[model samples]
Target: MSVIIKAAPLELMIIGGAALGAYIIANPMKVIKAGFKMSIKAMTAKGPQKQDYVELLQMMFQLFQAFRKEGPQGIEKHIEEPDKSDIFKAYPSFMHNHHAVHFLCDTMKITLSAEMSPYDVDDLLDADIKAIHHEEHMAVHAVQTVADGFPGLGIVAAVLGIVKTMAHLTDGVEKIGALVASALVGTMLGVFGAYGLIGPTATKMGADIDAEGRYLGCIKAAMVALQRGAPPIVCVEYARRSIMPEERPSFEEVDKATKEIKKAA
Candidate 1:
């Protein structure tokens, strides 16, 4: 039992370090550290909220509405200087996320460039969002791969322990019991690593990535609808409704936000 308690935690550090050290030796330490940091962030960041997205859609609606009523010239005031844009300035968190910022700005720029169908722009932007997510997925995949291998290597550790115990097969009953117990520890460690820690963490990161995908999709829908010349209220509605139902706001919630946006503008 003592063997079980002591070796179990070490199984992760030992197996994980081995896998990571192998990978790190092949990749640059800087890149590995960045991947490590993102993995940690993935673990911590609870992800965007229903409220965050609702506000985002509200702000997007305000922006799109102004464009429809005032034309591209209307948004130029805000886009040229988003820091001062009364709408964007209000949602500083959304503004600070570079990916979200670039996604919003690039789509608007494409729309402003000429007579482009918003639907086509929406499809292209969706593709872009997918590409960004796919790249992030690679990092996720690597960490998961390491996690997957840990349990198997832990079994290998257990097997080695059993082999060591066999060499003492003649040590009599008490020693044999201790040896057998120690050998079984490796197996316990393997199973624990598989189910308790690494697997859950990998699954969590995947969920995080999936949630982020939805948020970006919301951005795409709102901007595309705006490009198609929808009302700001209607465009925001498009964005808000695109959210997965769990993350979606009530119609009344969106309505209130849209109303306030209008009152403010």
Candidate 2:
């Protein structure tokens, strides 16, 4: 314990400093910023939850109903300035997700302003999803790369400890042993950091990224259905089906919620 206490700081400095330097070198400025931001988010951000999806589905249904009844002009005010739209403001959780808001609003704008078939809309939304996924995953990849290098960095720390131990061999058996033991702490820290901490963090970030992508995919499914002239309820059902089972609101739940929304309208 004493040896670890004495040696841990230097070992951590070496491993942490090298890892930070490597991360900076490997990633662009944008990705570096994003990686740090995402790492913080991974710890606190609960991706999209069941209630978030419920709000999202409800919002979409309302938007579709408006468009169906009154056409493009009806939705123009809402889509153009979503931050100020009463429909958007009503669903705070859905509106809070800036990426989701832009994705939905931007796609709707294009669909309304241009002559696009369902296939073209699908292609466009696919391209948007891919672009967002690629951007977010780059940060995840950067973090994973650092996690992978931690073990090797630990070995480096251990070797440095070994080198220090060699010089103290003449001091005494107790002193030499202490130095050797302290050096091993570096190895332990490295392995623990890689597997027990940093690696798992990277994995969490990746999972969150996938969850966000699925959220966007849900929007895509409904948007395509809307283009095909599906009714508002059917369009939202298409979206609800696209959600992962764990987070999907039940069909009855959604139906009841939409009925309530209609009553409010």
Candidate 3:
């Protein structure tokens, strides 16, 4: 216990400091900032829950209804400044997701302003989704790289401890044993950090990134359906089908939600 207590700070400083330095060296400033932000988000953010998706579909249904009823101009005000739009403001959960908001609004803007076919819209949304995924995953990759290096960094700490131990060999067996034990702490910490903490955190961040991507994909599906002239409810149904079954709201649930919106309208 004494050996570990004495050795832990230095061991952590060595492993953690080196790992952070390596991360900074490997990524650009944007990615470095994003990695830090994403790491924090991984710990705190819940990603998109089922209710969030329900809100998303409901929001889209309302927007599509406006577009269908009053034409492109009817929906323009809402898409142009969603924060001020009563329709957007009604779904606070959907509004809070900036990525989804921009994804849906930007596609709608292009579709309304231009004459792109559904195929072109699909390609455009695909490219946008891929770009976002790539940018976000860069941070995930950075974190995973740091996680992968932890074990190796721990080994380096152990070797430093061993070197320190060599100098104390002439002191006494007890002292030498303590020094050696202290040295081994580095290896233990590194392996534990890599496998027990950092690695899992990176995996979580990756999963969250994927979840966000899926959310955007849902929007893309709806947008494409809208371009193809599917009804408001049908557009959201297309989005619902794109969701993973585990998180998907049922058809009846979506149908009922849209009905309520119609009633409110």
Candidate 4:
């Protein structure tokens, strides 16, 4: 069947404009701006990828090897002086991210200082990461809510079209058909906004959240293994395998890297 191409930008403007006006009236510009910023971040900044996992393992292996060579005292110097640590300098992305930096360093520092049980420390720190991500979830909820309302809002747009059509009842059948068709476009816009834009955005945000969650889980796996006194090779493996398959490196890759560290030692 041939497609009927319809141009109804003005009609969409009427409906979408009214919806946006209402949102503006309900929310302050600052709150709206913040929401906008969050939306942009969600769209632009994806979660850590597979290479990030590989880098993390590489870093952990190096650090663990350092600890093995010079004992806790050597690792302590890095923790105490992260700015001076060549290890921290190696991964600019991890180093630049204050959250990631603090998460990694704080756990190891506590292990050194609190004399904490590695498993207990891992559990407590995992809880902390969950709480942090939970707070970020408000952004996800905001997007999903926008999606849910879009279809109904489109119906609202359609009603305005009908109201316009009713005003011109004396018009010919041709005019009425045009009016009805124009009105349905609002409904169409709503469904389109809901499914095509907002719904997909929500799904993407969820995936991003899951990816970040896996990153934190890697930290947990490594820290737990270290606490349990596993060798550096085994400890990094726990972290490496914690990664999702789409991003996980081969075992041989990790093993070869671990061997390189041993060789360097």
Q: How close is each model in CA RMSD to the real structure?
A: 2.8, 1.1, 1.1, 3.7
lDDT of each candidate versus the true structure: 0.76, 0.93, 0.92, 0.76
RMSD of 1: 2.8
**Evaluation by TM-score, superior candidate among 1 and 3:** 3
Cα displacement (Å) at residue 34, model 2: 1.2
**Least accurate 10 contiguous residues by lDDT in model 1:** 26-35
Off by over 4 Å in 1: 8-13, 25-35, 80-86, 166-172
Question: How many clashes does each candidate structure show, in the order listed?
Answer: 0, 0, 0, 0
Candidate 4 lDDT by residue in tens digits, 1-265: 0111352576567656765666566665654564566567677887787667777788889998888779889888777777788888886766765666777788888788777787688787888788767755665665676778778888887888899999889998988988888788878878988899767877787777677777878878888998998988889988988888888989988887667766766
Candidate 3 residue runs with Cα over 4 Å from true position: none
Query: Can you tell me which runs of candidate 2 are displaced by over 4 Å?
Result: none
- Inter-residue clash pairs, candidate 3: none
Question: lDDT: which candidate is best?
Answer: 2
lDDT of 3 by residue, 172-239 (tens): 99899888899999999999999998888889999998999999999989999989989887889899
The predicted structure with the larger TM-score, 1 or 2, is: 2
Task: Write out the backbone clash pairs for model 4.
Answer: none
Q: What is the lDDT of residue 53 in candidate 2?
A: 93
Each candidate's TM vs. the true structure? Answer: 0.85, 0.97, 0.97, 0.81
Model 1 scores a C-alpha lDDT of: 0.76
